[model samples]
Target: MNLTERLAAQPMSNPRADRVKDVAGLAGRSARSKRGLFLAEGPQNAREALARHLESPCVDAVYVTEDALGRHPDIAALLERVAGDRSVFVRLVTREVLAAMSDAVTPQGVVVVCPSLDVAAEEVLAAGPRLVAVLARVQDPGNAGTVLRAADAAGADAVVLTAGSVDVYNPKTVRSTAGSLFHLPVVVGADLPELLRAAREAGCGVLAADGHGDVDLDRLQDASAARAAGAEGVDAVYDLARPTVWLFGNEAQGLSAQEKALADHRVAVPVHGRAESLNVGTAATVCLYASARAQRRGADRP
Candidate 1:
C-alpha cells in the first residue's frame, strides 16, 4: 500500500517481454484500434492524460522509469495522487523497458496507455461551437498536431480531422500537440461535406483558406475592425466575430477548388514577402486568432 511497495511490485525489467511488446504495439493504428488503447508518451503528455483521467478515468495505466521519476518529481507526485484508484495501474520499469515501449529513440521515461480521444462529430457540434478548425485530408502528423495546438491556443471550441487526415493519436502528432491535445475536443474521421452541412445548419459560416481567393485576410480584419468601430452596415463585408469554421487542407496540395467551394467564402492570407505561402498551421493560427480577437471586441458593440 506504501510508495516503496507500489514501486517494486510491478517492476518491468525486460524489453523483450511479451507485455512490453504489447504496449509498444500501440504505436500502430491497427493495434491501437483492436485494443481500443493508445500511448501518450513523455512527462507532459502523461500529466495531461492524468488530468483528463481525473475527469473521466480514460487512462488505463502508466509505465515509468526510475531516472525519470528522479528528474520529474511532478510525475512521481502525479502517480501518487492516482495510485489509490483501483481501475488505474502504475508500474516502475527499467529505462530500456520504457524505451522498448516507445517510438522515441530516447524515450521520455514515461508513457501512459489511454483510450482513443475521439469524441463524435455530434459531440463537437452539439454546443454550436463559435470557432472551429477543419483539417481536410491533411497527411502530415506534425502539421496536424501543430494546427490542433494552435486551434486550442486561439480558443477554438473544437477541431475536426476529415477522413483522410493524419491520425491525431499518431505518436508524432501527439508529441507535437504538447499537451494541447487534452485542452479541447477533437473529432476524427469526419465526412467533410456532412460536417460542413451540420456547421451551416448550426449557424456557422464556413471560410476556406486559399491563396487565390477574392477575400483577403487583411481586408477581412479591416472590415471586422471597422464594424467594431461603429462603421456603417455596408462597410462590414465580413464578420469574423460571428460563428465560423475555418477549412484547412494538406501541406503540399492545399485545398482543392472543390474544397474551397464548400465554404461560404474563400479567404486568402496575403503573402507580403516573397515566400510562396504560409503552411497550414501558421495560417490556421492566424485565422483562429483573428476570430478570437474580433469575438472579444464585443465591447465596441452592444
Candidate 2:
C-alpha cells in the first residue's frame, strides 16, 4: 500500500503510547546511543533527513501530524518518495503525539527517527578534505551545533567533536544544526591528538582559533588576497589557500594550552570593537569563511 494510504488507515492518536515514548526517548543520549538512532525534529530537519535517506536509507520512520503534512506538502511528498522502495515507515499522528515525541517547547508537528550519522575520524582525514572543524571539549550543545551549522555554511568538509565534547546527538544540538547536520560529515568522540596527527599526515595544516593567538586572521586574509592577485613579495605567515583543519574549543574556557599547542598555528580573529571577545560560533564562522574564500579564490585563479 502507498504511504498516504497506510498513514490514513493507521492514524496514531495516543500521545502516551509505548511506541511514542520509544521515539521520544531518543532525546536522551543513552537512548540514542543504545538504539543507534536519534530524532530529527521539525519540517526542515525532517526534509533533510528524508533527503539523506533517499541516498543512504538512514531514516527508520517518520511521524507527522495531518496539520503539518498540510502545511508542508514538500515534506509529505518527500516522505512518500522515500517510502516507495524502502522500509521507511510513515505514520500520521495527532498534534499531541508529535508534541510527546518532541523536545521542543512548541512541537513542530513532525519528527524523524534516524540512525546516528557520525563517521570515523580516520575516514574523514582519509578523504583529503580541504577544510575541517574540530571541536575540543565544547560543552554546550547549542554552541557545538551552531559551529557545525556554520562550518556547513562555510563549505567545510567535516566537523569533529573531541572525546570530552558534548554529545553531537543531543536534542538541542540537533535543533541548533537546523538541517546542516545532514549536509556534511560529523565525527564524535574523536581523540584530539590522534585526529590532529592524522590531519597533518593527510597534508592539512591545523590552526587553533584563540583569543590570544599569535597569528592575526585579517593579516592572513590580506596575504591570501595578495597572493591570489599575483602581488610581488607576499610574505604569507601560513597559506590559507591550502587544506586546513580548524580547532575550536569550549564556549566558556576556550581552548586549553595543550589543545592550542596541538595545532600547527594559532589564529586570532581581530577585534576592532569594544566587545571583550567573540563567541565560539562567531569566531568559527569567520575563520572558516576566510579559509573557504582563500581556497575558492585560489581554485579560480589561472
Q: Candidate 2: lDDT of 218?
A: 96
**Model 2, residue 137: C-alpha shift (Å):** 0.7
> What CA root-mean-square deviation does each model show from the true structure?
1.5, 0.9
lDDT of 2 at 115: 88
Q: What is the C-alpha local distance difference test score of candidate 2?
A: 0.92
lDDT per residue for candidate 2 within 125-200, as digits (tens), equals 8889999999999999899989999999999999999998999989889999998999899999998888988899
Pairs clashing within candidate 1 = none
After superposition, candidate 2 runs with Cα above 4 Å error: none
lDDT of 1 by residue, 206-281 (tens): 9999877788888888888888887877454578888999999889999988899899898889899998989998
